[model samples]
Target: MAGSRKIELTEALALGSEWRHMCFAILYAPDPRMLFGRIPLRYAVLMEMRFDGRLGFPGGFVNSQKRTLEDGLNRELLTKLGEAASAFSVERTEYRNSHAEDTTHVVAHFYAKRLTLEQLEAVEAGAPKAKDHGLEVLGLVRVPLYTLRDGVGGLPAFLENSFIGAAREVLLEALRDLELVEPGSVLNFKRHSFRQPSLNS
Candidate 1:
């Protein structure tokens, strides 16, 4: 959090040779499927419930000395999404934002890619069998792209849950950037009623 500030992807890539790079992305599909025969599942975005009990996108560190950022990112995708990730790719053109954390000599890169519904499902189905499953990657979380009748559930509720670092920021930016959700709509969420979680839930 020291030397970190939002900068162009190219600028981040051009940093002096002292920085390490970590890349992550938001994988989403054009989902027209209906939920419970009523609610429309507009966009299916994948986020992981990390081992640390925080939510973040599916990806990991990329050693520039070993592989290109895109290649390293794909390698991580394969590890986290299992064989289903074979067909998915995140190109450099999809790069979104980059922030440099000078304190640790690390720079974070964010990406967003679109997949078909079928392809997305394959990733989801195969995630449980991925190499990092249940370890660094605890579970797959599909962002609820819609709001309930009272505007208090779905995305709003999902927002209430904890997110790690820039996960929440990237998610909101992607939602608006992709036109999956209208701009400024996320801020109008109604607060949810307080309820205790069940031990069995």
Candidate 2:
């Protein structure tokens, strides 16, 4: 019955409405050899539209008619990625709200899924053909732990803007569920400007 609450697009627009949020899993595979003694794991982030270009995860708003957040996300993934969605398993989720100081109350639900190396390969191979809402995703980025460190400076434009917090939270949850990352491995970074640092002499 809850899913039956149909908020028409026109009404939603009038109310400055918000839509459902979704994301795909960033999986890591352990590698036996690494110079820093850190686990060699494969990481993934979504390629979405931003001022700069495509970044972030594969997700979007939930259809009001769906029973759960997962239902909506799964539907969108399947629709956009086609058989690529079949390669991974969605393992966990988290829910939160937007921090914007506006009347439009927004709720976001993030999900994490794990895929085999072969599955990841399939996704990479299929990304060129995937399209959602007329946007063509560039595909997932395999981030290394050192990249999060190495004083590399910043995240991608879309990740910096949209799902930075959610990304850390969901990745931690996924790692914990899989017993991969340590309990505190997920570090929440403070919000910082993505603009290039000024070099005032």
Q: Model 2, 1-201: lDDT tens per residue?
A: 111222333343344335433334343454334535753443443344422343445656565444455567676676566567766545434322221213324334445455555666676667656665345454455544333354443333322433333444444345446555344444433333444334472
Candidate 1: list runs displaced more than 4 Å: 1-4, 187-201
Task: Please give each candidate's TM-score.
Answer: 0.88, 0.55
Backbone clashes, each candidate = 0, 6
lDDT of 1 by residue, 38-142 (tens): 998888999999998889998888888878899999999999889999987899899889877767878888989999989989998999999999889998989
Can you list the residue pairs that collide in candidate 1? none
The per-model lDDT (C-alpha) reads 0.84, 0.46
